[model samples]
Target: MIFNIENSDVKVEIPALKHYSSDLLSFNINKLEVNYTGNSNPSIPACVQCSHPAKPMPDSYIYYFEVKINSINSTRPSIVIGFTDESFMLNKVIGSSRKSFGLRSDGKLIHTAVQTMDYCPKFTQNDIIGCGIAFISQKIFFTRNGILIGKAFDFTENFPMFASATLSSPQDSVLFNFVGPFGFKLDEVLADEKKVFNNQVQEEKVDCRNIFYLVKEYLEYEGYPDTLQALEEHMDLKKTEPSNSGVISECYKSLDSSCQNCETQGKICNFCTKKIIETVEAKTNIQIPEPRNHYNSISLSSLYLKNTDFLKNPSKNSSEHNTKNLKQRGILRQIIITGNIKEAIKYLTEFFPEMLNDELCMLYLTMQEFIELIKSREIYKALDFGREKLAKFRNYTVYYRKNYDIPISVSHAFGIIAYKNPHESPLAAFLTWAQLDLTADLVNNRIMMRTQRPRSCLERVFKHFLCMENLYQETSFVKIF
Candidate 1:
């Protein structure tokens, strides 16, 4: 049956009863509902098992299925809902086999006949029994009528298991729900788990000072080792000093409360509402004392370089060669940002002439030049530039397509000339200041590739955190700190 997963975009098809043992079973046309057709015999029980196990989610999520007991034999009332591995014997009920687990009508949780225990209360006709496996933990849990019944069994080994149900009497009829709008509150359960996990994380003592070293490594990786000593001194001061300001008034307490939950917690507060105070302090000559903490008081401006002044006037601690390279790159960046593609290319040709050999960089410069020409309304010049430079690289455009947007951008840039007012065109995005800024960034990255590592240590750290956050979110619906 095809259906969507709760709280996720994924859609899955569960294997239905297509080829089950024919002796005592009758399946409906859709093959999702099954009924026992054999005589009511206490000794003989019929079970329908899926050939393949439920498909597991790549990430950490509970994979499970549910069964709605539509009708049951009033005399025996014996229906078993659960999962079984490949080793399971199709002739017997699921829990009777060594590699299977099931919840019976008598309120007993059974993992093989040898391992049985009274778990939750008995489930009967019209009741929905949800059985799921938390893949990461390798545990089975059951839910009864939208409420969770605790974990049933912890498996010692991983096995591919499929959903199965056994019927003891002829009157037994069941409907399987694989992908759901399940009766259980799966989203809420996941959210609660996440909430608990986050609370646990919050209670644990995390030395956020590790972030200080991450920043230091990032700055050094980006060629700013001299900034480390200054950063370390500032961090030490922040740790030692307390807030200099007096107690906040009742009216200002709300602002203080808002800052406490800022997204930039443990980093510089760039978009925090509390930065309003700093704006006021900077605009007026008023001195507003703030607590020397990481989140509220510090802004991004205080932490890193906003411009290339550091390259122009290098610190005594910096190497002369590195300073010279940075200064050249800064000039190239400025030239590109100012929309002077010709000047930037000339500057590159004079100093970093080898960079011209890199076709991707050349394509970017060519595209930028075309944009500049278009902006000046030199349509024929732009067309000529495209034919001479951009058109020649069409064969290799596919090769550069993966790493850069230049291929699609080249087409879009050319399309801009079709309009008398290019600004009104759908491809007008290529005309924006943001596009110029991106071109400058790409050129800057191209330069960095020759001189330094492509990605910064800070970017790797954030990516690592993001990966961990995703893993946490897979099991728990909410994000952990």
Candidate 2:
């Protein structure tokens, strides 16, 4: 008996092998013929024949036929034969050549000289010697008399087959064994782990600056001292005034007596003469005796004594002083109180020397307070200080324009102040000026009259502030987006 395998649509002859029914003979089978003819099964039939009719064969004497199974669209197929043990000696022809047996005459199995090749049709007689022996025993085993080769016949031929087999398996253990780290070295594993560890360490080493620390340092360096003792110590008493009419008259008489020679000579009095001599000496790199200014001396002495008295008796005011003396004392106190302004200006100049201009005094004060407020987180106090300082300096713009040869306009000054102190309410007025399109209007008007270019410091400052604000807004927008 022979079995046939065929496609549903195509009918073509396939090669096969055959064995006799009585176990008397075996023969090479030719191609089994087939026809489609629109048949439902579309199969080919295998043929078997026996040369001797007198031989009585047992029902166990089964015929075998080789059937070729091929992949779809393939012209050839791997061949395997099915049979019963009666026609073939299971042990005698187990693993022999195609024309020989791998069995000794004593009915025991023996080795045969036959080599297996991948995808080759070279089969020995032992290849089919034990084809159906396992069927009777109901146990599958590889025999020395049988060819039990897998798809691979050698090491090189096994590689691609093993790889594809691994990929097709559903078991994880099989996959790991075949495709994962089955052959990795210990050093390679350690190196990879080290690389990952180093990357994590690098990520952890980044330094972030603390905003609080920056604010604290700025405040300590730039903020005004809270106590009045520092200011009192730094103030010069000689530049101050006395507090009473008797004291004032006494000081004037003293000056008049010391300045008599200057008056008699018709030269500038000793008071004015002393100022000239100091100025000339400073200019000429000369040193001379300090000239007398008796009124200045008496005023300085009285002011020093009064300041000491105030320190000794905080409850007392200078009651004997006249209005003029009181006014002089007030000016002196203001200078003393604000003496640190000069020091603050010096410190600020170290960082931004352009801010050393006298016009920027209020700016300096506000910046100092800003540093303090940030350090303390006293938001409301800072805001109030900023408002007061900005209001005070708002008029300095006009004063600067009137006093300086530089042709800065009030509008430009406002713009500069607004740019510097954007948090202040007065900055709104400056922003309004910037938004008026006045700069272009002025330029157009100047061109019409063919005037020289106007100074544009304020406009430039305003534009710079606007550009900074735009950049900040753009960066923030990108983060949000």
Candidate 3:
């Protein structure tokens, strides 16, 4: 049973009044408006609180509510609009305790009864006052009508804070716009805060820029000239190497020195050819005979081919002969990306038969092929493929280990057959582009390991940070990915 609809979006509701001091205040039919009925002392105001805490939106990191002054009962109507913890007394002013914060209509900011400061201009009837809580900075801000006033106070506690208001004058009423039809364009405020947070994160992650640079270096080292060229062009970068004292460096120098002679004789010089073969043998620790023709030896030139289009112009030594291996590997990678498992297997068999010897790589390819069949609703074929290829790995302990709980197992993956629409199942997280990307990356790593090349520096860094994230149960480091 695969469901097609996505459920990534979240819904946030507006805060509304739950209950208040019944003796001092009265509410209309709807709890959105409150009025002072009994005489509350000017200093000890009647407080009304919303039903729920001002919970931050997980993505936006803020919560906000606004109140419009509907009427004033006295010449000095001391209305307070702010937030307070549940422990605060409802019979007292909202800002009369340390656990509460408020902006009074008289243009004063108060955190405790004894501590008050001149904050902003005083508000009168018909003025909409908004109070917002910024969780990241732990600051409270106010707005008059639709204009933002400066922040008033900072709190260090993590207690739940509820939206609240206090009235000091009899018959003074205020209307709350919990979920709006708002007078203020709150979207702009949210955007600005998000931007500020991102800037702060960017400043802290200065080293992350080098990770992409490492990836660029890896593409070049792996002989992906086209991909390396595209990456350089897209990011406006230049190619750079970390070291200049390896067999690779010597080989490059030898080729450069002999380029003119090879171009004249229409074939690579034997010195440069021998260096290329030695480089491959050093990396893989596999001995091979010296090739009489460097252009025709698939075993020696598979990784060293610079120009794959050499067959079209054998007489021209400066053609695509150097990139032949890169073109073949690139095609294989594209085949995997396109989810053409059969074509990928055939390509590997034809060019890099050694990859088929990797059990893990074979398993990932077979699993991807099974998933493709499942996606096409070929249930009989999928079941047949699973029984033939995946049955033996049903209880494979390596995949089911606590640290590596892959969902695509015989027991878990076969459960999809029970659903009419598999995407609706809890197991649907495995049926995503993320899953395909994971398979492709695993196969690519296997290929790189088979060639005995060192793992990419970017991959090493990512794995290190991911391990740190798991060990400390912190997500900050993994956010870069």
Per-prediction TM-score, please? 0.53, 0.14, 0.48
What is the descending TM-score order? Answer: 1, 3, 2
> Which pairs, if any, clash in model 1?
none
Tens-place lDDT per residue, model 3, 308-394, is: 222233222122432345455654555565565776687778777988888888887887788777777898998898899888766
Name the lDDT value of residue 414 in candidate 3. 63
True lDDT of residue 190, candidate 3: 70
lDDT of 1 by residue, 1-481 (tens): 9666686766655567646657788888888898888874454787787655865533325676789989986655379888888777767877887788898887888776877789887767899999887654457889999889978888877678888898878778999887677888666445554565567677888678657656754553344423643575467623322221222211233234345433333322323323433443243222222434532233322222322333344444344465555534544554565675766687788778989988778877788788888888999998888888788765543212223444463554466778999878766767776676677667767766766554665787789989977766775534322
Q: Highest TM-score, which number?
A: 1
C-alpha lDDT (0 to 100) for residue 9 of candidate 3:
64
| Angstrom error at residue 475, model 1 | 14
lDDT of 1: 0.65
Q: How would you encode candidate 2's per-residue C-alpha lDDT over 1-481 as one tens digit per residue?
A: 8656464466632223223342222233332211111112322212121122111112222111221211111221211222212233322223232322222212232223354223324333213222111112122221222233211111111111100000000111111011112122223223343455457676775333323223222211221111122233344322433322223222232233445644443322324333433333243322222324442222221121233222332221112322112222222222222222333333334433543444444343444334344334466665576566655654443222112223333334434332344545433332231222222222122222222323233344567889977864655522221
lDDT of 2: 0.28
Quote the lDDT for 336 in model 3. 61
